[model samples]
Target chain A: MSQGDGIYPDDLKYTKEHEWLAVHGSIGTVGITHYAQSELGDIVYVEVPAAGAPVVGGEEFGTVESVKAVSEIFAPVSGEILEVNPALAAHPETINRDPYGDGWLLKIRLAEPKEIDALMSAAEYRKYIEEEAN
Target chain B: MPPAAGPLKTTPLVRLFRDMGARLVDFAGWELPVQFSSVIEEHLAVRGAAGLFDVSHMGEIEIRGRAALELVQKVTCNDASRLGPGQAQYTVLTTESGTYVDDILVYRRGENEFLLVVNASNTDKDFAWIASWARGDVEVVNASARWAQLALQGPKAVTILQGLLGGPLDSLRPFRFLETEVNGTRSIVSRTGYTGEDGFEIYLPPQAAADLYQALLRAGGPHGLRPCGLGARDTLRLEARMLLYGNDVDETTTVLEAGLDGIVRPAKGPFIGSDSLKREKERGPARRLMGFEMIDPGVPRHGYPIRVGGEASGAVTSGTVGPSLKKSIGLAYFPARAALPGTRFAVNIRGRDALAIIVPTPFYRRPH
Candidate 1:
């Protein structure tokens, strides 16, 4: 999505910090939402935890740096990292281009799947960001 | 977040910027556009063609009277006596200990009159300093609110601005300015800019700024003159190795240590920091601000700890993934002995050390 264009797929859950999680059984995929990447202007660098690292809910797992500022990425639920996007380091701009699809930051094996209930749904996250922009 | 004083101040071009879809952000307590499109796009636009900027937030001070030159000479480090009418020089307002009060551009309007363009956040402080030193026949007035500034910079800058002037701008040498009519509005047009490009900085009455801003955009549309914001400005100036005041140099850093010995002229006379500068020059500064590029994977950020030869020395002052060079470059203070072209250091980014090497700066010099 481009600037001012908002897209929140109903299959995903989002955090107040703007990371989106896609759950499938015991595994989940994570990436920053389109709203977050647009607000960042341009992504130049990204640092993520290695696979098998433990992540806690609402805790910082990595950092996303744009041309002007740096933003910390917080996990929405507790999990163990399964895999990280190896292509993200050299092509950080991919997050700004295809944030939801190819720009996924990491894959995790859920440690507390019930924690997903606390995340905002697509419709709620859309409203959450709309309120944030004001 | 809003500053403690009140809402962020807006420039005269704020509405126009919003109309053009600019992403506004708070910069030094002023609300200004960070970018219209993207930093990389705007940065390359200035390098390839031209880019316009609303720099109206910058402070302007007029020093007028018989002792104008003397008051300016006493406060600033550069020798303002060498400047004649229509000439300008980049100088610094120094403190008693030879540290920077602020960096400014001194423009000589006449033998007994001058104009100082200073940083936006340092306006009141700089004015107070200049006013206190105002003895004899000098008058210091903060004319910041009375003017609006527009910088049209890059290779095509001259061509884009020449049509607005009644005379040619081709003959206006760098650092020279003239009081002329811009789009029929009385303005000060200077052949100087921070982007290291051939350009003009036009200072106009606030009332005439909005209309002139649009006119220039219309005239420059064909030349690919995109309206840039502070994001591009920062990146462009970084590539040129121009230092930002609050970040690169502050009260703790002396002019000599900031790599600005060329502007310190103690031999001319005793200015605010002249005595201290002279002492420091004789002994040589212990530390100096130097440029470096990360050799390992990580981006150096401001306030990041820096280690020179494995010992904690200083902090990163200004850093970014250079939009032009595509390298993580930054400026940092290091021990004088370690300030060399090939000297290697480590930047502590969130407790992780990233190896970096000092490199020759003005990292991306444009082809002449």
Candidate 2:
């Protein structure tokens, strides 16, 4: 119930692990949802795989550490890493501030474009998280 | 993330903070707020102005009757006989091996009355341990359920709390307490805190907690007081190099090894762990706790292995990127030979070894 808690851009597809993917043709930008960042508290550091590394769907490719706990960030769909967020090394709290925009973790080249169809839409994700709360 | 339901214990201020959008987490077994707006913001607020914290989860045990001081002197490692009425001392409940049962605060209420404040998670264990040593007319009671505690910490703490006092608090020095009324409620106000700051810890009845909490916030708003949670508490205490019972010291860590030899009073005569601590003192502790700051980019975390001068050393006990100092600082146990300042270390962060160096502790101290 804090800032950016209710935001879920309609253009982005969501994963059950709390990641959001914004697909643009064959390229997609990935970031954790606002709920994930808020639940993790104050994020101090982030570690992501370097560009050109291939990642499998539903597997951990990076870590997000807050003051008290560490969480794994998973890939929503199998893809090759195109770029990792350089800003995160110095300012990881951007995830808590503007998660949907500047906080994006990585840019990936999609292996299967059809994978987006299987993911949840913004409204569907909102419903999914509501059920998750109970 | 949602309302904490089920078996987790909650403090009296849960509902008030939950309504304020504070993020709650499971600490030990209690459902408590971790942060209000953010940990860094709350931490900075405490350093610049003041912060109010709900510490009602801390356990309180009261001992009364003719043999109260005798029973206290038997179980704790400090010289409690030195305390006059209305004074408090930081001491440890020592195990037979000269290690900690729990680090606690002993308050001498009167000649035959004392109050021991212990860690929340160790309440039941401490009570049972104290009862086993009771061999006289003294009565030991777990008064945790009867009291609610609040900590007002930082430079502005006195200015904010002085408004509610019926009389001036000039007589209340550090580590001193007085039975008084705050904002019309009878309370015990102590000039002590875990954070290295000018603060007061107020203890009152359970039901009166919420009202005083709101009153303090209202009175403290203009003075720049923020409602802080456990996250800020941990960060603040770490910056001050205060030991966390479960993290920095425990049943396996001796007081001497933790660099607390000053608190050990051998001349007070035989107590629990006295004989073993005496022998350890003669031989010197094999390992010692040292404070360090990271020279590399990674943050040191609890239980992470460390290497000193190319050999495996102990793990980190407590660590955080200090909000006040803005540096990654931590405490770890190392071989006594390598425990000095300027010694280099490599802290294992996940699969990578990050560079660290021993530094003088109290990474952040308040400017006078």
Candidate 3:
């Protein structure tokens, strides 16, 4: 669990790319950090992977646009998307306003339990965000 | 007049932007402050109140001699003959194939003197091109270093200037200029701006620029004037649906492609690109520029592919989600049929599909 910087949840594991994953039973919930949303600005558009789409670890899964720039969002773990953020369609700026809550991106059915072990803990993710800011 | 041969420099305004905690970005090889405040706040200040801008990065070149207009008219895509003394005209210089070299706003100081305000990155190239095609027995002196520009833009701009000028500025109207005394120094004030707001573009000596900016800040600060950066100017212009040179039009983009044929007036004179433009106008542009909005949550951007009926038709040249309209707006070249407002299409942004609708250019309008 990571919490040194950014809005890292102690209950979740994270990728260096800034994705946080929360495991519950056989599923994992995923979303970018508050730091990511702050850096991206008011999200204007989102390209979400369709439900049931298989996502490979270290692969791009979606894109987000703010005012003038676009950033690609990557999948943190190999899994199948069970649900995508539907609220983001009309209110993309929610990512900036409430990135960790209403801005949650997707829920995926976990492909491997060992992948979670490789992810960062809350304290580690916080330090990672701080270094990136510099 | 050669390719920019030195490292790019930042203006004092960059420091000001940094002090205001603006997000700095690389623009034209220069580190420019994108937005000091929120893009919406600064943009609305220009549209509603007054917004001050640091436009010192723009290039200025002086053309002096009797052949000034002669050379200028041939070099640009506008009728310079109508530009009397103390008047300005917006025009574009094109290549032999009719693609844009750069867009400029030319100020005619007198019958034999002119000034061309050009895009910063293209300054050297524009100077070189104008020098090589010198039809005028005149001196083309680059004066970008000795001068600076600050734009005070809003509905209240004239009132603020009137207070500073100590007299009515009657001689200056839209596109007109006046050489007046400001702070004991001669300054040129023009009734023009990039934002759709009524405003003034002030030109003064570089040393005097900082003082004048301070005075303007102190005077207008209480009246809701904010020191806006390029970020606000961009969003404001985008709201007005004004075309940005490098974004909406570039070296490979033509007058017709950008829907600027009305300004071309092919019969103006025999000039470079006249033949090509005349033919292109007759043949119709291969693609037409369009304004679009995303129906889905996907912001299309420059270089993003525009698809119609699942076929690649064109690519975006400029794109953004407007702060005012709260919609994703983009400028792209597409088939004439796709240019029609209300036509539906898809934008492929980083391998993701965004449903797009062809909307009219300019997503925002001031109520008349």
DockQ top scorer: 1
Q: What are the per-residue Cα lDDT tens digits for candidate 1 across A8-127?
A: 888999999999999999999999999999889899999988998999999998999999989999988898999999889889999999999999999999999999999999989988
Model 1 per-residue lDDT tens digits across residues B263-297: 99987788997888999999999998889999998
Writing each residue's lDDT as its tens digit, candidate 3 over B31-111 gives 777776556678778778898988888899898887887788778887888888999988888888888999889999998
How well docked is model 1, in DockQ terms?
Answer: 0.81
**Of 1 and 3, which scores higher on lDDT?**
1
The DockQ assigned to candidate 3 is 0.44
By lDDT rank, best first, the candidates go 1, 2, 3
Q: Model 2: how far is B159 from its true place, Å? A: 0.7
Q: Report the C-alpha lDDT of model 2 over B133-208, residue by residue, as the tens digit.
A: 9887999999999999999999999999999898788678999998889989999999999888889999999999
Question: Which TM-score values does chain B get in all models?
Answer: 0.98, 0.98, 0.94
- Best-to-worst TM-score order: 1, 2, 3
Give the top-scoring candidate (lDDT). Answer: 1
State each model's CA lDDT, in order. Answer: 0.92, 0.91, 0.81
Cα error, residue A41 of model 3, in Å, equals 2.1
Indicate the residue-level lDDT of B367 in model 1: 92
**Model 2, residue B311: displacement in angstroms?**
3.5
